[model samples]
Target chain A: MPDYLAGIDIGSTMTKVVIMDNGIISSVMGPTGPEQRRLANKVMEEALRRVNLSFKEITYLVATGYGRINVPFADKQITEITCHAKGAAHFFAEARTIIDIGGQDSKAIKIQDGRPIDFVMNDKCAAGTGRYLEVTADALGIPIEKMGPTALGAKNPAQISNICTVFAEQEVVARLAEGVPLDDLVAGILESLASRISRMVNRLKVEKELVITGGGAKNVGLVTALSEKLGCTARVPPEPLLTGAVGAALLGKDMVGKALKQGLPLEKKERSLREISLY
Target chain B: MAEEQKKEERKKRKTATEAASKIGGMVKAAIGGTVRAKEEGKKLAYSFIVCSYDEIIRAMDIVPVWTENYAGICGAKRDAQRFLERAESLGFSRSLCTYALCGLGFDQWREELGEMPPDAPWGGQARPDMMLSSGQILCDPRNKWYQAAQQFMPDVPIYDVGLPWPMYEDDIEVSEIQDYYIAYIVAELRGLVKFLEEQTGRNMDYDRLSDLVDLGEKTWNLIWETYELRRSVPTPMGTGDAMNTMVPMVFMLGTQEGYDFFAELNRELKEKIAKGEGVVPDEKYRLLWGGGLPSWFALTDFNYFNSKGAVFPVETTYRMIEPTYRLNIPDTDDPIERLAWRWLGYWTYWFDKAKKRPGSEPDVERLIQYIEDYQIDGVVMHEAFSCRTWHLGLIWQLNQLKKIYKPIPVLVLGAGDKKSLEHRELPSLILESDIVDISSYSEVDTRARIDAFIETLESTKKSKADQQ
Candidate 1:
């Protein structure tokens, strides 16, 4: 009989779902494919199954991120920018600035006491997004997940001058042909990406205590270089990618509380999660 | 029956754009005016939008065709891709301004085929007798778009006139260099006149040119006053409509039709205000589009905003007749000197004010003024990726505004039992897209940003009311 809330963030690269019920929070993450409805259902099913809950028991559902509109059962849709700020605020009570580098876009959200006051995003170019790092890592023959720790051991990092991901990959190949150390090249790529992010973050008049969320925050090398360039120690979420889903859950919980106060339930449809196949 | 039909029509939605578009249609229909002039044994000159050379061109009895205008027509019609690909095929990078790319491509294709491309937009831009180019600071494409294009029409001559202005800065006294700048511009104008006179085989008419300059100055005042009327509560017109109406302001300035068009527009706006009509019914939020040229392909987004109860009372982009009346003209009888001074006036209007006010930028100052006058709830800007002239200073301007201005007064908690006060900054949103490249734009992302901004504005509004 507990009131539950569901927050689903269907991003360009990943689909994440967070379920909150009886003061317990759990999440499931998976790759997003062309079939957004299937991805949304699969993640939601996994998250709910972990919590031993039914879709009917969820009081409110909020969707966010670029592919948010594809979530058919979402009661309300909010932007990832606002959700990221709320999600960061959940961890750091005084977190004023959020640097969220996602699959294709990065956002710098300014939070004032848990509410997003302003946000700046780099959606026009792929230079500073996770895509930049992904392509560069492919050229370096390094696993995307292991790029951080491997990059940390560089004695002298090669300087990457190109911000364009394609040109940066070309530079990586050229460096490899020149017999440049892989660790140094990776370190240079991370450093260059971090400096690019630092410039975008500074535009929002970044204030401390800053929190870095999204998949890119997992890279320890990037986190370290960002700290050095931004002049602040950055805080990373335990599951950086789930921050958006977590934020959506928080907003969804708030919507549930409001709907309960007004004695008006939100609009949502009951559907069989089993019907959706990842294929 | 007639009255009932009229009432039904009144209830139906109609755009104020028709009035401005009428003038634009006439102008576009005159596109092949250069070709017609050739048939009539008349001379034609190709020029850029910012040249302001129409007065001299008209005085010299030369037909003037704007390359930028032609480029814009192709953009609005969504016919630019063909010309863009042609330019790219000719080794011109797509990173260049689409306006320039489209023109260069069309010129090359026309010269190759010896005629207009199959079903070109606006019957294709007319080939020119001579090209008139300008060197304005900020737009590198304006300086280079024609030079690269001239390779196709090797016989046609180009008169490149330098009309550069000092880039905006904080410490430099613009007046210290104003005299030299004006003198240089005057000399350049004279040099242009010499070129035109040589091409047309006619003597320069100073009296007629002076009359044209006087007319342009009058139109400048009228356009400024006409847009100023939008500051009224429930503004009568929106910036999307202004984008259409500004054709005369861009092309027909220094002419009687342009002055009349604005005069009639001002009167219409005053009547709409008297009747208490707004750009949209239920105008919930008044937004100020502060800077950057709009994405031509996605102009319908204005209607989208309108559907969301957002009314754009003013935009700082195309309607840039901010402060023309306040310029200090030098003591000279020469119309070209006055033209030089007027050009400086438009650019330095806010700089002079910023000089008087500590910690102010021309662009940011204009933003603040428009925000207050228009009763704006939020500021939004489009950052076109290709052009740095309009896009580069945007982030700096936003940061400067946040640094200096605290417009929102909200209640706050103090150390003691008594409540203290705090001031918050207005929210600024920057939406990034290319001016002509449809590929760069994502409607879902843009709308999400807009929705988030509206939510932020809603919160800011609720808190502002809470203080009472």
Candidate 2:
């Protein structure tokens, strides 16, 4: 039987699963909900169904991201930081730096020879993450997806000086009250967020080719602003949101391969793809 | 729901080491002793730790109420919230040093109530006859904390002693300024002695002070030796226990108890090393707690690292004792002069070596030396939100250290292979929180960061092994 491996990433705002059999078989992404365990199971079940397989067919599994421990059936858990580095490296072999701005946190990881050498994360704040843009977008009555495109169309981007997300939202409203263009407001928001993330990324001595991953990377305007700030054009994977999950799956395969090479028993759960019963 | 369940399933943290466990009783007695000092006719004085005046106070038979240690006890016991709230209400910003705020808040409450605050940790910090405000070069709060406390108790006098050292300069030898700095410190000590004599209505005892100073030097040397044992692989003790052991070294410095405790601790670590015992059963990665004061309330964070197969063999916090014999001080019978010399020596101990090291300052040099000596795989630090004195330089130090290369001997292969050396950069992690502010802490976030750091360490280890 061909060996199968799976990776699940339960981020603060999104849940993703990627299934692999030597190469990628299927991948799924969805918004995370309060019921993390159910969401994890449901996401995994969907990804498995897409590949016509059940949990038992997986040779090994790994979970990553903020809510990784919530996936009760995962064979092992790794951090999203490591998963992102590996996944970015997989997509871009020469990738040396990764800037991942997720739902609630942003991090810059420095890579050497496809391995994470160092990283720095923003302090406990939401000013430099996807949450910042989401809050600003809601305040401006613009969809999070539209903010990026709207930002790219700006004739004159307003200078946003507020470092706090709440204050930045207030600033956006104040600018709108003064009849500032919506595109300019959106551009200003992305610029401020990019600057914050760039400052953190610079701490690692950022080198090219920098790959921007995570849901935040899906924002073209923010990615461009960050690349300009970093003085290096950044690359975004085909599916930025799926990189962490893909990396986790690849690491799971590596673990299984190592276990077999050493003739060591692999630790895994007698599994199910169904949601765990509360009772 | 499953995350909460996993958190619940986590094993209870292990207890402190044997020597460390004894700190609780010692601390209780020391605090209780201050409360009873008036009844026993011993004058009680408020003092800060590491101010280098413990011997003088002891010789004068003045009982010291260690305000910072009391604040730390309040933090450890989770009883600091009430005091913190009181201070915040009194116009103290929450962003100020929490230790100072906690101490100030306790003093304000006590002065108002004319008694101890409700449920004060360890019978409350006793009211002092006088306050010694440390006007040190670092810790601006130290110079202000006692003076601010004096607002409530106007009758009590305050003594501000400046404990400045020759600030680090690569070109200037410490010997050039040692005489001037020592003279200034000696004058400060003499002024403190005069102030104490006036308060107690007794003349200064030079002979007794000399003996106490000698004892303090002995205790300092003993502490340096005791902590040196932690350099052993799979260290028998770690920073977690050192936090406990630091109480005696910092607070009880001129006393026999302090020296004896370290003597016992030294013996304990030696025995553990003999049997090849370590802090954890399987020590995977040895880490250095590179900088910053720890979150006193959440010391279990250390245990959390231990559970992940990481052990902190050494930390650049609280372990303040350095070898005193390294400095050349003109032999002086005057205890005050010797005390001043010792103080200057301790601050400048790493200057010469730091100057020789490329891209290194004193703090960074100490970190590099400890990493090499302890065989550290990575560096971990806590950045207390309020204490910028220690937290500010950490980022720059790590950045500078990364820029400098440390040659690691590697064995090459396939071309008449021989062992060659390669320069490599060390990995580091910075945890953010406050020394006593539990509100700023998040166990989930901290653990996630730790997990990520461990992964990075694992990857680096694998890369190194592959290269070899």
Candidate 3:
């Protein structure tokens, strides 16, 4: 039997699970619907199946993300801030900053040695997150997955002054009525997003060896614009969306190691993973 | 959803209800105060919080109605949206301060109806005879809210007091600059006196004003002494109670009633501490409610921390008032001059202290002082989006504190052996919410964040104890 460490990230819009068995990693992702409990269990089962393991075989598991507390089977729960730091450190050990643009919020996390030194998150607004791209893509009649590549081909991007999604929608509609091309509008929206990300990054005054994670990292156009805006190369992990989940597993591993080294009595049942901490 | 959390929230609601009951009486009396003033043909003047004009108004026989307090009433009752929407309907932006919007809307509606609006919170806020607005460097809303309200009642005159201060600098002579700064603000307070005398057909009585000023000064000292008593282990009161008890300090500052309340409060707190009674049992972690205005609707969240065995020993919020004793007042026969010195003194209390310490910023220095004095293990702050004066510098302050402050020991596990060290800055949690807008707050998210932070404190405690 192989010992395993698992992490489930139940984000606002998506859920991703990652499990590691002796350095062999497997992960899965899906849309997070109205039911967080169901989503969390489904992602965990799917990730476990991919790793050729049963739930009981996993030695440690940590749950994280926005709906972190809702995961019933999670042995522990941690904040995405610390998890992202751990994941970014796994990707680039020297990563000084991590810029994560999730479905609902954007954050700039200052990282040092797989730990968060300082962080600042966008106040509750849909202005500079993945939702902005989804909304703009829908309004432009472009697929959400295709908004990135399409934005890269723009020759003249239409300017959008509104940082708010509602106002930005009005601006796009007005531009469309004035005969502005769709591609330019898309490019402009992505550019505006890049600017917002740069502002949060600048707030921490840390620009060296940056990593972009979450669903935003998959967007080539955003990556390009963000790199230029940041004036440095931004690295995306092998699996950008799995960073948070991977970070969760890393913490689980550390928790198990620490617990064992302390000579603490471990749970006897094969079905129990042994609780360390819930948060 | 756990039974513990529900029971904790229930315990919180009990205290919240008590606070609410007290607020209801205050609001009703203050509103009825307006009605009575109208019946008696007395003048009513509107003002903002911390403007330090309550004593002056009281001495001049003018009724002081605080607009910000009314906005908070609407918030605590969850009845602010109607007035907020009305303000927005009048071409005011929703992005503007909710308190200002609520006040402007309530003012416009009351003036239009020639009475309080239907089902107004606590019989609605009173219409002012004149308005005293502060254009302080702190809050832009203070400068604008009354000005906008005055537009609704054109006959009502407005006096704007610009209480500006020098933001701390390394390259300037602060004391000499402060001397000039104090003079300008003194002139402004005197101008308010002149304006009030004209608004009410009455002459200024200097002696009575001095007495009132003395009462106000004593109240500040009393509140400070009362607040300081919380430094005891298992603090007798958390910032939640402070938010309620501060009603007098903010609104009734110059009154003997305010002084009496503090006297009773200090006596009760001392008794509680002597008896070893605290906000909670088995208090594990002491936290500093560091900065920013609290979410009026969700103040009970403070009690949620209490449920987790975390007691707030100190807060650098609106309640951690500038001690009246710290102000250097020049020998002056005029109480008005002393009032000016007191106003500047409160605003600049941390500046001199901050400048004296190495690598110390004002706000961070205060946090350090508080953490030491209060035996604080962590810091918690509310990031109220609506107010820039208190909210903007918060992140920077936390960042600086983390950079400069050294970690204090919790407890060593093995006294004679190599112990585990929980080395680093004190953990800080920033909860984001609006001061008045309930919609901006999510109980689930906030509760989860706080729960996690408490766990962090617990882990730090355990780590320190487990050191070998």
Candidate number achieving the greatest lDDT relative to the actual structure? 2
Better of 2 and 3 by lDDT: 2
lDDT at A214 for candidate 3? 91
lDDT of 2: 0.86
Where does candidate 1 clash, by residue pair? none
Model 1 residue A209 CA deviation in Å: 1.2
Best by DockQ: 2
- Superposed Cα deviation of residue B302, candidate 3 (Å): 2.3
> What is the lDDT, from 0 to 100, of the residue B430 in candidate 3?
85
For B280-355, candidate 2 gives per-residue lDDT tens digits of 9999999999889888878888998999889988998998888778656568899998888888888898998898
For candidate 3, the lDDT comes to: 0.80
Q: Compute the lDDT for candidate 1.
A: 0.81
Over A127-175, each residue of candidate 2 has an lDDT whose tens digit, in order, gives 9888998899999987899988889999999999999999998988999
lDDT (10s digit) by residue, model 3, range A1-279: 556888888888899989886663788898885654354677777877886788878888888888776466787778888788889899899898899989988788876556665566764678889989888877877788887888888999889999899889888888888998777888899999998888877877765789999989999889888999988899999888889999988888888777799887643222332222235
**What TM-score against the true fold does each predicted structure earn?**
0.88, 0.95, 0.86
The sequence of per-residue lDDT tens digits that candidate 1 reaches over residues B1-468 is 556634533342235444554654666667766557767988878887657566888778888788888887776666677888999999989888888888898999999999889888767877889888887878888778778887999889989888866776778888787888888888889999999888978999999999998888888888888898899888888887887777878777777878888888888888888999887878888888888888876777787788778888899887745445588876677888888888777777788767766777787788888877888888888888777788878888887777644544656566786675655558778988877767778986788788888877776676667665
Give candidates' CA RMSD values in order: 5.9, 3.5, 5.5
Per-residue CA lDDT of candidate 3, range B205-236, in tens? 99999999888888888889988999998888
Residue pairs whose backbone atoms clash in candidate 2: none
